[model samples]
Target: MHKVSVIIPVYNVEKYICECLESVMAQTLSTGIECILVDDRGNDASMEAARKCIAGYSGPIKFQLVVRAENGGLSAARNTGINNAKGEYVYFLDSDDIITPDCLNLLVERASEYPDAEIVCGDFQTFPQKDVHKLISLQGKNFPESSFDKSWIRSVFLSSFPVIAWNKLIRTDFIRRNNLYFREGILHEDDHWHAQAYRHVSGLAFVNKVTYLYRMRPGSITMSDGVEERRLENMTLIFSEMFAKEVEWDKPWSDWILKSVGSLRYIGNKANIKEKAEHCVSQLLPTVYKNQSAPFILRLLFKYYFHNGVIFSSRLFYKLYAIYWKYKG
Candidate 1:
């Protein structure tokens, strides 16, 4: 079997697709890898561009291209690739992001050292963006080191990192055995999947060296107007799904959802979606109460907003605080 199946879900990323593919082709690791490029019905010349880049490729790895008939979203594209993967391990690569030459090599080495590991992750740097730089402190630049657990992930997820498919390599047998696939038609599908995946993980590997480059484009969904509402709705859905599962009730996970809603409220009001912001809070507060052991600070924030009708004020505070930070930075 192939060692790794690098799945790249292609959309309309004509600008960066070539560079992204090249980075994979240049990987120093000569392991059995399958580069499966799934084209999700793009209008642009992205397919043509991808074809040109792959024509001269003569690496040890096998390469294949797939073109889907319908324009399913990112989750569907990824699921398609995963369903067809012929490797012992899988790594999902965003069409627009680029990986370092040694990323696969490092991850494979780490996973080999810990053969029982279901997942292995490495550090990644955001390709120089103005506001993105402000969000991350220089002191926090070191790679993350932690024992993998639901609570550990819940705490780390609070910092608003992109804990999506890109930075990790997953064991294919575990995924297939568990029938784990991205939740179709959900905006933040990764959040939901990771919660469950983290629970089932018998072993995990964290490499504090090497890196991937996540390019920030202005038109990305995170930078769009509709994202605020979608995120709020998505978190509500995720929290409900988590509770319904057979796992133990997770207080930290509940707290994380509240924080997500709180952050959404802050961004929604700034985006002038006050009514929608209130709607999200209403859906989220009941779940917050289920966590009887929640910390006082979070409970207080929830009580003040829900009981005192302080959501509007809460929203305003975030807006002003963001403006101040923008000016100060």
Candidate 2:
């Protein structure tokens, strides 16, 4: 079986897709790699470019293009890739991003050393399109000091690692057993997926050096106009359903969940969330731990919203909460 399956979702990234695919083809590991390109039926020649890339490639790696009947968005394409990956480990690579030639080589090496690690994350940096090639070709395939001292490894606090899906090599069985599928129809899907996926990790590690190069596109989703409105809307939905999906609450990592739940200090006014959605958030609060270990303000808000709103306590908490927000936010 292949050691790693690199999943790249193709859309209207014709201009950058070639560099992305070429980097995967140039992996220093050479063998035991399969690149799965999911064609999401974009109105462009990205697939045409992919076909040419596969045809011209004279390497040991196997390339497969899965064509979807319709464009189901990034999450859907990612789900399809996860469903079809036939490797021990799977790595998500955005079509607009490029990885160093030794990226997979080094990640596979680290995974081999730490067989129990479910998710091995490699460092990544954002680069302008003009500098992508230079970034990919930068020297230093190995990091002796970073690897030796292990200063690069960090404990995931509430899944705090970047939240981006790319540049992480995840064990296939780990993802499958935990049902870590990306939710479709959500804008910041990573926010929800990252939180869920990290909480289940028995062992997690990181390769500190930058292995992935993210292209800084002008009209990227995060920088697009009217994005803040969409972000707030999706964040509302994320906080609403994140805990209702029945995560195991009695495990050793339960503290993580407690911290996550205790941090919901939103009183329906922060993001101008609709009254109905705010009610949904309030409903979920009671089911959280009786003594939540989440962030301080979220705990305060929990009392303010869940309790009967005693006038004196409410006023006092509001004053403190207001002060906290004024300085912290």
Candidate 3:
């Protein structure tokens, strides 16, 4: 069996797909890697580019292209790739992103060392196409190179480590056995799947190496403008499901909620979506204020805002703070 199955979801990334495929082709452990390309019926020439790259490829890595009949969004495409994966571990990769040559080798090596770890996470860097030289590494000082069992799940979740799916190599059988799948028809599907994995995985390991290079495309859903409403809706649904599952509102959960509120406030202020912002603050502020996991200063700020009926003022304060920091820097 293949050591790792890299699942690349191809949509409208025609311009960047070739580089992504080439990155996979350049993996150090080519013989034990399988690259699964899922074409989600995009109208662009992304599939054509993928086919061309695969056809011209002379690599030892096995490749499979699965073309869906209908366009089912990112979550569905990921599920399709997971369903067809044949490797022991599955790693998600976006069509616009590229991985280092040793990405798979590092992950597989770490997994081999920790045979009981069902999930292994590595660090990553984010870069824009134009500013590729100015890549920003996301390695955290808090995340030591170590293996963690189920007891450390909360600490893992609360650490500076990112919750993104692409940074982790997950055991295929673990995911299937736990019935962990991305939520279909949602934009922020990673949030749910990552939460579930953390909850159910027997153990997880961290590899302190930069393996993945996440490309910050301008038109991507997370970066694009005018998608605030969709983002807010999806995040709300995700949080609601999480709360329903009785996930403790500990420090990590509180931190996530606060960040979510901050994002909603920023988007609302930018787009003048007052009603949505007000509603979200009203629903979330009480829980955020009550949770003791957040920093004392943040909790105090929330308390002041809640008592003073100036919840919206935090947005202005954040903007001014940003400007101050920019000038200071």
lDDT score, residue 37, model 2? 96
Candidate 1 lDDT over residue span 96-197, tens digit each: 989999999999888888777787877677785623342332225443543456555554543433456676889999988887888888887887777666
lDDT of every model, 2 decimals: 0.72, 0.70, 0.74
The best candidate in terms of lDDT = 3
Tens digits of per-residue lDDT, candidate 3, 37-79, equal 9989988999998999999988788899998889998888988
| Lowest lDDT 10-residue stretch of candidate 2 | 145-154
What RMSD, rounded to one decimal, does every model reach? 7.4, 7.7, 7.5
Better TM-score candidate (2, 3)? 3
Per-residue lDDT of candidate 2, residues 1-329 (tens digit): 99999999999988888899999988899889999999999998999988887889889999999998899999999999999899999999999889999899888888888788787778777786434222222234342322322223224324244567788898999989999999998888887887677556666666767799888887677667656556655765775576555655433234444444333333233344434334443455444423233464475465554654432234544554555554455
TM-score of each: 0.81, 0.74, 0.81
| Candidate 3 error regions (>4 Å) | 128-138, 149-151, 247-251, 254-263, 281-309, 313-329
Best-to-worst lDDT order: 3, 1, 2
